[model samples]
Structures are given as structure tokens and as C-alpha cells.
Target chain A: MSALDSVPTAVSRPELRAGEMLAEGGEGRVYELVGRPGTLYKAYRRPAQLAPLEALIAWEARLAEAQPELAARVRAATAWPQAVVTQPGAAGGTAAGLLLPRAPRRFAVRHRDGTSRLATLSYLTADPGQRAAAYGLALPAPVSADRIGIVYALARVLEAFQRAAPPVGHGDLSTRNILWSLERGPEVFLLDCDSCERYSPDGEALDSGHRRRAMTPNWDDPATPAGANPTLASDRYSLGLIFLRVVGAAHFPLQRRQRDSELLSIDFAIPPAARRTRSLLDGAVVWSVCARSLSTRDPARRPAAAEWVSALEEVLDGLGAMSAARAVWAAQGGGTPAPSPTRSAEQAADVRVRPVAMSGAGRRWERVRPPGPGLPALPQSTRPAPPAAAPTRTAAPAPLPAPPSIVELARTGLGRGGELWLGAHRATLASLSRAGRRRRATRQVIGCLVLDFALLAVIFYMCAMVAGVLLGI
Target chain B: MVNVEERYAVFPFYLCLDASASMAGTPMESVNRQLPLLRAAVGEDPAVAEVIRFGVVTFDDVAHTTLPLSDLSLVEAVPTVVAAGRTSYAAAFDHLRQTIEDDYHASRGKGDRWYRPAVIFVSDGRPTDDRERWQSAHSRLTDTGWKRHPNILSFGFGDADPAVLAHVSECKPHRAFIAAEGAEPATVVPELLAGLIQSIVSSSASVYSGEAQLVPPEVPSMTPIPVDELD
Candidate 1:
């Protein structure tokens, strides 16, 4: 059946001309609307897929009525279709195109060569050196806090997409389609919103057969099979990839690596420098979410956009604390501050947040942790302690060493024996018959037999020495 | 931060123009005028220019690389081509076969991954050489065993033969186009080249679309020459 035959005639139909052509994409031509200053027209090369397009517009309208604030945020960050443009004289007024707000000037960056281009994720996903050479603009370091802020912003947008009644999947969330900017703020503007696939309110896919499902190379979700429709799961998968690539500032295919070997870890995909620099991805909370989202084949295991938002928010908060602490230290003659009594040992160990001296500045301080949203505390034994303060008055007896905190106790307790006994008291007894225990017992028996042979040899040597002395006399 | 060899995707397009004596006056002028627009269209958009590497190859009795494959944004200006000598499809095909292989390895060394190369062939006259010689060169250029064999799109006008143009494009439907009968070279040349600018821009955008395709130009003044169905 023809694509236009399925559109309902009752829908409101706006009109647009061929107009002044601006740019042509793979699917359509973007044109400037005559009277609408900030609005542009995107005319499909083939007849427009009205069902999904209308569904997206209707979905946004419903969102406006229900949640105006969220609707505004989505509208500001994305080029959502404002209306559908119809051919003036076609039968039943066939929809020919869509009118969308133009991507704002803030999203465009001027290169050193004086040509202006949209600041897409392509500018963000490469090395700082290469990006400068190619785009003529130096980007923030891969481990920069601003890069995490950008990922947090993107997660919020995807969270909004998931919040829709049926949810809309972009299907093709790639570097080229999403324009990014940190010029004004950590923001991203989505283009080609009409190409997004919509679902029925009951959570069933309403994708018609007319529109071709879009996916960009390298950015395509490895979990999604060819010819299958895009789903919320796929979108979540894409979001995970964007997070890894953007934060790492390298285009390592995490999914492809996982496909090759299920044992592959996120560490293999992450650059060694990023790992050493202790970027936000190094934290257990954020890294765990990214690992779960990409390293598994089952879509059900992937973390949702909302999960990403929370994780990113927590890490970014930790980064903020680190920055504040650094500033405090820099202000107070650049020295390592002593650990605060109120600071949990895990916070001191994991996040490395040292307590700044309040006596110098005469200001009260609140105890701060690295990140506060239920993050797992990582264990470490080799981190150096802060230097002790020099004695100014009469010498005093040193206090007994402080007892181990619960985290340190747990760590030490776990390490004392190479095995962990869970559940019952008898579990350790049961483990004694295991292969490892057998190997240990066998090694002990072999050691005792060798020791006995050595003792006998010593006795024999002593007796032979006495007999030799008697024969000489 | 990662020292990964991040290779950027590039879509290489070779504009293989027929620069025979017949194309000198209006046809050649139209090409020179329209070629710069391609640079402007691609160079202005860094997103598109990042992935597209374009070159111009002009041929008559002998073929010459008028422009080496390069990023449009990096090129200062496109050099103009002048028409002379009789048409030899053999020279064009042979030159293209050699150039594509050389270019592919050179580009790969510089960390560029390529989509299949696209060859846009434009001609105003039929080949003056024997069919066997040209066909052999064409076979070598389009050999399935060769990884760099380009997808060719043929456009013909004036004294050019539709059958040969069809053969040049391997008789692929929508790949071969001929100017409508009695259309002036001045009118046809401009429209064809203008359409080609849009075609190149659109095709380059497809590289980002996962399945890279060779999009044919929509020349309003021309019509597609239908290929005969094989028995």
C-alpha cells in the first residue's frame, strides 16, 4: 500500500514551499521557510511517513498539556517537529514534510579555517590533539569534569524521551545527528526528530512499514539485529555507547569486543590513560552501570536512561567535591589536609576527600564524602596517609593506634583467608574437602617427609665421623 | 586519552570527466564553473567534509589526474580542466583502476577507513578506440576480485551513445542517464553538473547512514536508459 493512503484526513495540515534550499541530508532536504525566521522545512525525498511523524507530534503535544516544564526542556534541547507540512493540492492533502525549529547558533562552532559547522559529537569523541588538528578547536581533556557534565545532560534528554507515554526511540542516535556544545552550557541539540520511531500507549511498536529504520555506522547498537525494529532497549544500549565513547574521548567498540569474548571487561575498552587518571568512569557506581549496559547481550540487563542519570549525577557531584577540596588546599598554602574525624574511612579511601583545616580560615566545615548516592566503596590498602602536623608545644604521649573502621575491618577480614565463607558457620568446614584444601594437605605431607629424611642423614653423618676417629687411634 | 588508532570514515568520489575535443566550448566550461560549487558545498559543512574525499580525473586519448584525492576543506581551489584530443574510454578505465588502488593504500596509511569508492563518469562523445580494448580495461576496473572497484554512474549527452553509457555503468538500472534529444549542451551541461553537486552531497551523507549507498543524481533534463532483462 502507498504510504500516503494511510494518513487520516482529520489532522491539521500546515503548508511549506520548496523554498530556499539550505542543506541536504541522506533522507531529505532542509529548506528555509519564507516568513518563519527561526523555523525550517525538511522535505522527504520520498513521500513522508506520516503515521510515526504524527504520533511524535501528538506525543509531544500531550506532554505539553501534562508536563509543561518537561515539554519546554525537550523542545529547547531537540528539534522536535512543530507541525507537519502538506502538499497544497494533493488528494486529502498529503503530508510532504515537517517544520522544525532550526538548531540555534550556539550549537555551531567556527573552525580555524573560518567555516562554521554544527558542533556534533564527532568533535567530542576523538583525541584532544586530533580534534584540534581537524576541527581547529581544542576540546576539554577526556577526563575533564565538563565531559561528565555533557554526558549527564545527554542522559537527562534520553530520560525525557523514555518518560513519554509509549516512549520514542531515536533509532539512530549517532555523532552526526546530535549537535553538542559546551560554549554556553553542557548541552546537546537533537536533529531529525521526525525519524524517531514511536510506540503505542500499550507499549507496542507502532512503526509502519514505510519508513526505513536508521542506524549510523560504528554507533549502531551491536545488540540490535539487522531488519529488527528499534526499541527502548536499543536506545538504552546506544546511550551506553555514547557515554563510554564520549567520556573516553575515543571510539572503541565496546559491544563488538564483548561479542568476541564474553569475558571482556569494560577496562579493556577503556583507554589506560583514562583508567590511570581516575576519571568519573573509574568510580564503581558509574562504571558498573556502563559495564552492565554494554557488556551483556540481554537487553533486560541494560541500565535505563534514568539509571544513567542518577549514576552520572553522583559521579559529577564527587568531581565537584574534588574541585572544591583542591581549591581549599590551593588557598591554604598548597598542603595535604588531615583526614576529618567525621569522614567515613571508605570516603577517605575511595574518593580521597581529605579534610581541610578550619582553624586557618576560622570557618566551620561540614564533613563531605566523594559521591553521596549509595555508591559502592572500593577497597584499597596502599594509599598513603596525610602527613602529621608538627609539634609546637610540650611533647605528649602518642595515643594508641585507632581501631580499624568497618570497611577496613571487612577488607582485612576478607584478605586473611583467600576464601570467603557465606551463609552458615559450617560452610568453612565444608570447604576443607575441596580440591584447594586437598592440594594444601598434599603439599604439607610432602614437606614433613623431606624434613625426616634430612634428620636421618644428619645422624648417619655424625656416627660415621665417630667411627673414623676410633679407627685412627 | 586513549592511544587507539582512531581511523575516520571517508567516502571517496572520483569525478571521471570525458575531456574530448567535442566538449571544448560549452560542455567543458560548464564543468569548470560547477566543479568549484562542489568544494563549497562540502567544505562549508565540516560534518560532511570530514568523511568525503574528492578527486577529479579528466581523460581523452590519455588520462591525467587533474586533482588528487583530498579533503575538500583542505583544498584551496579546484583546478579547471581544458578539453583536447579524441575520446579513449580505455585510458580512462585503466587510469582509474591504477589510481583507486594507489589512493586506497595511501589513505589507509593515514588512518582513514573508506566506503567503496564512487566513480561519476560524464561524456559528450563515444570512444574512438576498439570496443575490446575499452571493455578489457573496464573489466579490470570493475573486477569483483578487486576490493577497490568503484561503483560507476554514467551520464551522456550530444554524440554519446546510450548503449555504451549503459555498458559503462554495468547496465545497472538508474546508473546510466542520457540528456533528452535535442537538448543544448549549454543547458544540459549546467543542469547535469548542478544536479551532480547535490548528488555528491547527498551520497556523502549516506556514509553516516550505516549502509553506504551510491545515490544517483536526479538530472531533470535527462532520462535513465533502461537496461535489457537477461534471459
Candidate 2:
């Protein structure tokens, strides 16, 4: 009742006469507010009024009066709680949902022939981002650079959100929450701010516990206690997974025979799926930060959101995509050897069939499904989920990881905490150290092998030059 | 100037299947079995997996989307589509029209970079509905004056006419596949589906590599079901 008194309570309760239903999610249905342009009302399905949400709602109301600029920024970055919709239903215009502002123009696309479509981030992954609406290319093929740009946009938004006044943590951060637009610079609309974690400056608690929302099991960190809430560190882990998705989306790392459960993980030891991703990301500073460093299951070990911002900004500057990728090398001490040349499609295809391929048990295509006793019985969740609507590709969710920073890997050496986390694969760090040593030796051997090839190539060129000279005479 | 380089969205892929009575037994069974395999294969082939959304439209007496355009990762088991009624190409097209307008090209319709959809249509018999209705639906699907229309790759088996299949394939005779007469659909259907997967992969790969054209693989057991042959 005190919380109700604090919020703008309705005298007679607002009626929904106009405006159609825009979209529905885990929280409630959002309806375009009639008469009042650029605003939408969300009416929750659940009438239960909880205390945690009351504090969050009160904080938002206070922000509107106090730091409006910060509130505006929060709204721009995410659908921040603007006003609690009180529709006439049961006990006193119950706090149904919060009203959200309309998405920006950059959050949508227009067809060449003149039509517009709101674009979600899925355009970058599961759904092909290519279309004739590209306005320039008449023949239809997706542009490859755009996906990178979209991911880049995501990084910037997350950075902005994390740096906000009280600092918003997307409790449910995934591709589904971010709508994108290629019409301008990777413009996006961040949905469901109600579910986002917003702590009071005075340190009050807030949680959405969005279990009912569509979240892939792969996204959840196994280390976090079963009932514990997702933290900012978990958010970083999620971002890192996205970084991998962007890096390797062109060629997913799912081995031909690997199960979905195997795909869900937190260990960042360079899985086969990451090998090519590592190669493609070579030279980029963030690659070291993201692939080598931030991916660790250890939240303390992961870089803060601000660090990501600075690193990504540098990546986008006159370095990586600019000066022919010259300034894009690893962040100095991340001594992971520079990747070899970027391979062509043929080379990638060749690697797929190689007998001694992958650090794992080889390619997915090679795995023959074991029959009878050979295959162990799996738990029910591992079994495919039951029938539902067609799986919307744009809503693809989750990624797995747990890795060490190049700094820590060199310094503390996977720590006591990391050792316990590694469990059965406790020897992984030792093995990795051995592999690192082996890699050094192999690099030297490969260097000599390359030199030998170079010498032979020089001789052949010389012979050819002589032949050309003789022919001319 | 707006940065065109950053403008992009995922490629939308739709499968328009004919579940009319003619394909009831072996052909239908093969479809149910092989479709999941096709999806799994695509998942393994990253070239296509990253660039395309998978959707299905099955038509008999009516056309309904067994699956809306969905993320492949979200896809689990293929719904066992039971065969019934008559082939209504028009109904299928109309349903797609509604889906595109309401779902695909809704409120936020079309500024992102999207590859024109590539549709794979399979038929084992001729349209049971009125010719005008099918033609109207066909016209709407092929029309590009308003928005980008999808590219269709069609298959004709049994009594499904070569002319209609060619038409559905946008008169591209090369894209029309016809199974040999009297052949067991259980065997022939798998080959056709394999070819369809190849085309989908190639089309998606083109979005990145920019090398190949959107073309189907040459099916060993099937011949070209050209429109001229029927005419």
C-alpha cells in the first residue's frame, strides 16, 4: 500500500480503447498507447505485487524527478521503467506493467521499394542478414561486414548500460532482447528493462528472476549456485559468448557430432570451434581480452564493462578495421602466438577432413552414433524439448565458457578457485602448459619447415628465371 | 551518409511443402525423416547455419505454417506432418502472404540487409484449387513492386505437372526437379531433399563469399521439369 501511494496511482484506472498489441514477452504484453504517440503500455499477466519490484519502480520514479538526464540515458540504452501502467482489473489499478517509449528509427529497416521492418539482433546470427532491402545490391546476398558491425553495436550498448548512473545489469541478456537496424550504424533497441537488474545507489536489492522467460541453459553459468541471481560478471560472460558467436558465426564451432549439452559450457580452453575463431580474431586486441582473458568463469578475473568499452573503441579506431589491421595485434603480453594466414574456404574445408584434426575427438560428421550399450543414457533435459511454434531463428539464445586471462594464466596459473572449478579436467591447466610448450617447439619446427620451403621456392624461381633467359636467347 | 556497411539482418529461408494425399505414404514419410537430417546437416555446415532462418509451410486443403521462420538452434524435432485433403497451391501462397505481411514484414519491415528469401516448394500432384486463385497467390509471391519476393526452387513428382513446378520456380527450368516415373518416392524423395539442402547452403554461403549464384545441386536421379515440356 505504501509502494502504491509512492507511484502515480490511477483515480479510475486507465482504459485500453485504442492501439493494437505490439509484442508479448515473459513479463507482459506491450500495447501501443493511443492518442499519446511515442509511448506504449505493458500490462503484466501476473497480478502479484512483490516488494523487490516496488523498490525498483520507486527508484525509477525518483530518477525521473532527480537525475532526468541519467534516466533519459537509461531509457535510450534500454526500455527503462518510465511509468507503471495501472489498468482497471482487480485490487486498485494493480501495477500491471511499465510504459516503454517507441524504438528509434535506427532500430528499423526500409525496403528499397518502400516498406519498413523492425530488426532484432537475430539478423546477425540464426537469420541471414542479407536481403535486397540492402538498397544497393539488386541481386540478393547478405553483406558479411554488417554482422560484425551489429556485434560492435551490442558491445557499445552494453558498455553504455553498465556505465549508467546506478549501472543497469541486464539480468536476462541475450540476442532476443536486442533489436537491430542496419539502416544506420548498428542501431539497436534494448527491450525488457523491467527484467534488468537495477540496484539503488544506497545498495538496495532488486531481481526479476526471469525463469519464465526464454533462456537457453547454455547461457547460465554452472558455478553460480542454482538459485543465485545472474550478476554483472555473468553478463560479461554472456557478452563474451556473444563475442565468440560473432567471431565464429560464419563457421559455427559445433562439431558435426557434438551434442547440444556438450555445447553448453563455461571452460574457455580453446575448443575446436574456437580454433578458426581464434585464427580469424588474431591480431585484434579484444581477441586476447575476450577469447584469452575475459571468458573465464571467474567473474573477478573478467574485465569490467568499462574496460570492454575502451578495448572495443581502440579496436574500432585507426587500428584493426582501419590501418589494414596493422595496429590490431594482441594486447602486448598476451603471448598466444600470432595466428597463421587466414585460410580460404578450400583450406577450411580441407581442415574438416584431416585425419588428425581438432584437439577434441575429431569432427562431428565423423562421430557415428553408438548403438545399444555403447551410448550412455542421458537425462531428460538433454532430450529435445517438446513441440512448440516453429523455432524462430532470430531468437537463438546462449553460449558456453570459462577461461583464464593471459595475464593470470602467466601469473597465478589458474588459481585455487579455477582448479576446483576444473574438476575432472583438473589436469587441463598442466596439459595446457605442456601444450603451450609443445606449441613453442612446434612453432620453431614450423619456422624451419617454412624456411626449407622458402629455399626450395627460391631455387625453383631461379631455375624458372634461367629457363626464361635461355628461351629469350 | 548512413553507413551501409553496418546495415544487415539474417536471411529468411522458407520451405513450402505439399502434403496433399498423393504424397501420403513413402514420400511423406521420407520428408518427415529427412527434414530433420537436412536441418542437422545445415547446422554442421556453418556457411549456411549462420546466415539463414528456417521456416516451413505445408499445404493440403489449407496452408498453415507448421513452423514460423525460426532460429535453427531453437529447432528440435520435426513435427510429424500428417498428409490430408487436396493440393491448394493458392492457399499455401496466401498463407505465406499473410505471414510475410504480419510476421516477416510487419511493423518494422525492411531496412536491414536481408537476402531475398529462397523458397523450396515440393509437389506430387497438380493444384486442386481454382486456377485463378493459385495464379493470384503466385502473382503476389512473385511481385517485387512492393517488397522483395523470395526465390523458389520447386520439385514435381507423380502427377504434379511439370508446367506448374516450373512456374512456381519462377519459370527457371533449371531450378525445377522431377522424379523419374514409377520410381519409389521413398528413394527419390531423399535425393531431392539432399539437392534442396545443397541449394540452401550454397545460397547462404553466397551471402558471405559472393562467389556462387543461388542454384540447386544437380540431382542424379531427377530430371529437369521444364515448363516447355508440358506445354
Tell me, per candidate, how large a share of the native contacts it keeps: 0.06, 0.00
Residues A1-473, candidate 2: write the lDDT tens digits: 44425754222235544388987765668888778677777778885353444545665555645555444444455665556555565675256666667777667545343545455443344223232212211221121334444555555556555555566567556555776655444444667766666644443334445333333333444334446676655566566556554422322232111222232222222334324442234444454455322233345455555455445544444223422112211211111112332222221111111111123332121112211321221110111111131222212112221265688666675476355444524343354457447765556556556755876898899999999999994
Candidate 1: interface RMSD equals 31.5
Cα error, residue B231 of model 2, in Å, equals 46
Scored on chain A only, each candidate's TM-score is 0.62, 0.52
Which candidate has the highest lDDT of all? Answer: 1
Fnat of candidate 1, please? Answer: 0.06
Q: What is the DockQ of each candidate?
A: 0.03, 0.03
lDDT of 1 by residue, B24-128 (tens): 988888887887788777765655666788887778777877777877766556777778889988778877877788788878876679999999999988988
**What ranges in model 1 sit over 4 Å off?**
A1-72, A80-102, A111-115, A125-143, A163-172, A192-228, A249-275, A280-284, A313-473, B1-10, B113-116, B128-147, B162-176, B198-211, B223-231
How far in Å is the alpha carbon of A23 misplaced in model 2?
A: 1.4
Candidate 1 docking: what grade? Answer: incorrect
lDDT of 1 by residue, A1-473 (tens): 33223342222335344469988877888998788779888887766656567777777877776765556657877898877777656555346778888988878888766878788887777566655554467788664666766776667677778776667778778887888777655777888788787666544667656656757766776666666666667778778778767876666544444444444433324323334333343345565566566644566556667777666656555555344323322321232322221211222111111111112221121211222211211121111111131112112212232467999888887676334322222443445456668765566556555755775797799988998898984
C-alpha lDDT (0 to 100) for residue A292 of candidate 2: 26
